[model samples]
Target: MQRTFLQPDDVRDLVTDQFGGGRRPIALDRLTGGSKKGVYRLRLDDHSTAILYVWSAGENYWPPSLTVPDDPFTDASGAELFAVSHAALVAAGVGTPQVLALVRGSRYFDADVALVEDAGVDTLEAVMERDPGAAVGPLSALGDGLRRLHTTVGAEYGKLAAVARGEASQRRRVEDVIVDRALGQLRGAAAHDGRIAEAHDRIAGHVRHLRGAVAERRAYGLIHGELGPDHVLVSPAGEPLIIDIEGLAYFDVEWEHAWLQLRFGDAYPMLRPVDLDPHRLRLYRYAQVLSLIEGPLRIADTDFPERQWMLDLAERNIAKALAAV
Candidate 1:
């Protein structure tokens, strides 16, 4: 995969082509913090600002070589889905960035880009990191926003594309989908370190036991998939606008709640009363750990700084899951 960077002028031209002429960009600042995409804050001549999101061809996953045969969406399709999901969330009264235009399969650059209304400077992660005490308001707002998001339900549970095409009925149950993917990831990891095979089988048995429970209690809805503090931007007035809608999918609302608990349970205890299923939450936690394990293990030879940390997290979470059993 070839790397590509869009200059300020190129972005200005793209925006002008979409929104019309006479809009001049005063400053283009590359923003850091996202793992999957490059973001830039473009300050316009009218004192307004917009966000430019760019995603390279094969950089969606770590190691840049891992591929899933069952996954139907490409980078271009993902950008389009992001726009559609953002629109749906906004229409549902959820705080989200307003997408202006999406440039897919552009010849000028080897990446897909989306121009959107600037959400804010402070992500919920930054707010919580800077002041955990004051984070209650934003976190509560985030919880409320997620509740609103879950109200948008789908006919079936699976990928967004499959749902859109009315093919979600043919897809496997969300629990089985996750379990199969986790097992595949574990098998891939075991190719490098055979020690993971036993743990994989053990976790598989635990996951299988929870499948019946998941089948009985799951609700299909629009899930943010990864709603950690990082994807939420808190406006100055304390409104929480969700960004990075790429992971939007038709899945169990409990999955979203579970991820929230797994990521921020200790820092914020207010979510304990949100009525999440304990068994499903545990299953999702195991799935999250397996996901964390797969990426780093696939690229262990690289200079990726987080490789060891991810492996350690997976190991620790594996131990915790085992002890809970």
Candidate 2:
């Protein structure tokens, strides 16, 4: 197992500092499913539990093709951006863990840590997998939750850091970001295979045309860039709470809807409403697939299991995108 950044002693001390002395954490159970952060369930001396999220230092969670800055602690001073985003979601009446404390670059952990209330809810993915038939309620609740989330908007369409710092002028358009990234990935993949290179040339014009079409009709809102079944937790009573607000951004709502549809369209058809433009959604879907394959394609070899799967997926998505065009 990879060594976790947050230790038990560190959790105990953090809890004690937030709640005062003598309230030490009795247990620290590392939770799974985070890609770039360590999540732990910390049990306090009083038996209450909290969620500790330790941010990884300088890890790029997104594909290398994307232009997101490499800075790990993009959150403002004392993790102000992180705290503000969570607070905004809570204020919007969305179900989220109450942020108890935001530890910015602690010496002990050497990373930013957030202590939040543990909701002790099962993830929507878990519920869906365990009982597919009973997943309708939670899926519907998730749709409604997304509707509420989209209502929270930002001043510009980019990283929260740039927007919060009055640097929105430097922000790029969502359409441009997607198309540029897809082009870069497709070009790189093309270099490895003649078929991929041919497909890249064919898709290049289609991507640009689709980008223009979508840009003319895009609506901006707060989108959970990485929202999926796993990010949604459901209470015993069936209410859904969204976690992993790190990817939150103001962008085309179609991007979020497209991603949700790509992941859960068949399992939960109602997850995607019927009104979204099919062409734009397909464009985003193509962009998403390109993004997924970039990391694995960047590798020099295809012997790894993940690399082979990503290559196969890339082919399928390329065909799908071409057929749509």
Candidate 3:
């Protein structure tokens, strides 16, 4: 298994190139990374922080041969779209880290990397670890921010609305090509066969209900394709900022809303519902589990706990999907 690792020197060059004799970076350290990129925090002499995002093929340090489609809804340029999107959202009144400079380099380690200003952001997941109840404020803030962002996505990309709608309408066509197809490959590569067949039956049921529910709604317009706890941030004052909006796409509004309920309801105790439909919320929870089982397999380390959490969600969704079927 190959992976991209950013050394101290790599960060220094990135800072030097972007900052350019303005202020020499005093120190650099690895912060966090996703499946495709590694982030680093560059500390200036003034003690301010700038975040650097390095794109990589995977953990393998191998460059990806595949190219993402240049769709307005999807993030094809990797960090370019995210860095720009985050900056755009911030300028548009959403809470996002400031972009000091955006620099792109070819094959820094395994993938291209971008250096961005650090926002002192602690993911909602990290916040929940210390104070689970703090999520409400952030979650609420995130909701407001997402609403704003979804609006921008719809307005700014009005010219590309047809393209976005095309993708959404052709979603089933790409389902196997993008998701199910990749998951199939992963299944063959990594041999972890638990209750796959049973899981499929449950997922089928949930899909049925989800489709019907979507049909009933007029149209939610563009939404965050992936909206889980990890993608949200709770500021110190309890205000929420929704990060990682590159997954922006034209989808059912419930797709994004459901994620909040699942993470807050199941993972952390902070999210107690006072006025939301628990049953409908359960649909999003199940959707997440089914997707988790599908591909990439990004989650926590504890397998049993993760499995149980997703299974419980899947079962609930299965019942709903079956009802629709």
Candidate 4:
């Protein structure tokens, strides 16, 4: 299938078709989130707002190197998963962004999916930009949301066994591609830099550590997979509304802790307004960083400090992962 990208007009048409009122979107604006997915906010005739999330079925987005199946993950499958998981998180009482509607396959060769709804508070990255010293109340709410997500849906593990299996299986496949490519690249590159090799070794060790945690019957519920400050949105009431589960997956109960550490452990001192379990949070951050090392080398431009920061963070994660082992 040919790769197709949606335009503003195409998005408007999709909205009209989905709503079936011939009501076109008054304004179509691009959303700032997920690098792989295209999010849009549409204004309807009823003065209401909706969010559209377009998911593409391609290796270019996830990386051909990562362990993902060659088969395209169906849009319906994605819609079902997103609706269920997002709703379940909310039902579990997590303050996540509400999913007004999910529109798929309306554009771009059954690709270019979208989620439409009213916008949540500005992203954490935006908030931090305005008020760097803002209270941890928002961040705390985010942590709580993650905890809720993990604790809830314990039963889904059995149902999502296929998902877990696919993920684990693909983990190796994608890793193999990445390793081979990286090794080849490293070999051909100028003077040998130990960073790439060290990164590979350290990240591998971190994942191995996580495997042990899961094997020990410490399986936590579904993790956000990509739980970062930016992925979370703060509501006007100061509640954190977790958004963007593009990386949702199941893992050890403590993987969330590890993730939190890898991403925000460095900023622990700054999170003073809201009181939280500091020790556990740090662990989450550490594991979080470790997990990220093995993830796609690319980070969305929407993420602050740009791709450079992501690579830098990945490097940092590799070091931490090595230290842990």
- For the record, the alpha-carbon RMSD of candidate 1 to the native fold, in angstroms, is 3.4
Compare the candidates by TM-score and give the number of the best one: 1
Candidate 4 lDDT (Cα, 0 to 1): 0.51
lDDT of 4 by residue, 1-325 (tens): 3444445566665666677766766776665434556566777777777776766654134432332232122121355466655755666677777765565555533764655456564877677668866636777666566666666544222223345445333333222332343333333221123554555555444444433332123233666655667777777777777776544545444445545554565553343322234433444444344335544244322233246756675666556555765
Q: For every candidate structure, what is the RMSD over all alpha carbons to the true structure, in angstroms?
A: 3.4, 4.4, 6.6, 6.8
Off by over 4 Å in 1: 1-4, 18-23, 45-47, 58-77, 107-111, 212-218, 271-274, 299-325
TM-score, per-candidate, Cα-based: 0.83, 0.80, 0.66, 0.66
Candidate 4: segments with Cα more than 4 A from true spot: 1-4, 19-22, 43-48, 58-60, 66-77, 107-109, 132-134, 153-194, 198-215, 266-309, 318-325
Q: What is the Å distance of residue 97 in model 1 from its true position?
A: 1.6
lDDT of 3 by residue, 41-96 (tens): 77777677776666654422222222224322333336555654565566567776
Q: Mind sharing the TM-score for model 2?
A: 0.80
lDDT of 1 by residue, 1-325 (tens): 4544456776766767876687787787877544467778988887888898877644343455444444322232357677767767877778887788788876546677888888778988888889987788877777676777787777676567566777654345666666676667667766655556656677667767766566453467778777788878888888888887877777777778777777776864654335566777767777676666665666555544456665776566556545544
The C-alpha lDDT values of all candidates are 0.68, 0.67, 0.50, 0.51
lDDT of 4 at 281: 42
**Clash statistics: count for each candidate:** 0, 0, 13, 33
What's model 2's overall lDDT?
Answer: 0.67
Model 4 compared with the native: what TM-score? 0.66
Predicted structure with the largest lDDT when compared to the true one:
1
> Over 4 Å off in model 3, which ranges?
58-77, 105-111, 132-136, 150-191, 198-206, 209-218, 236-239, 266-285, 296-325
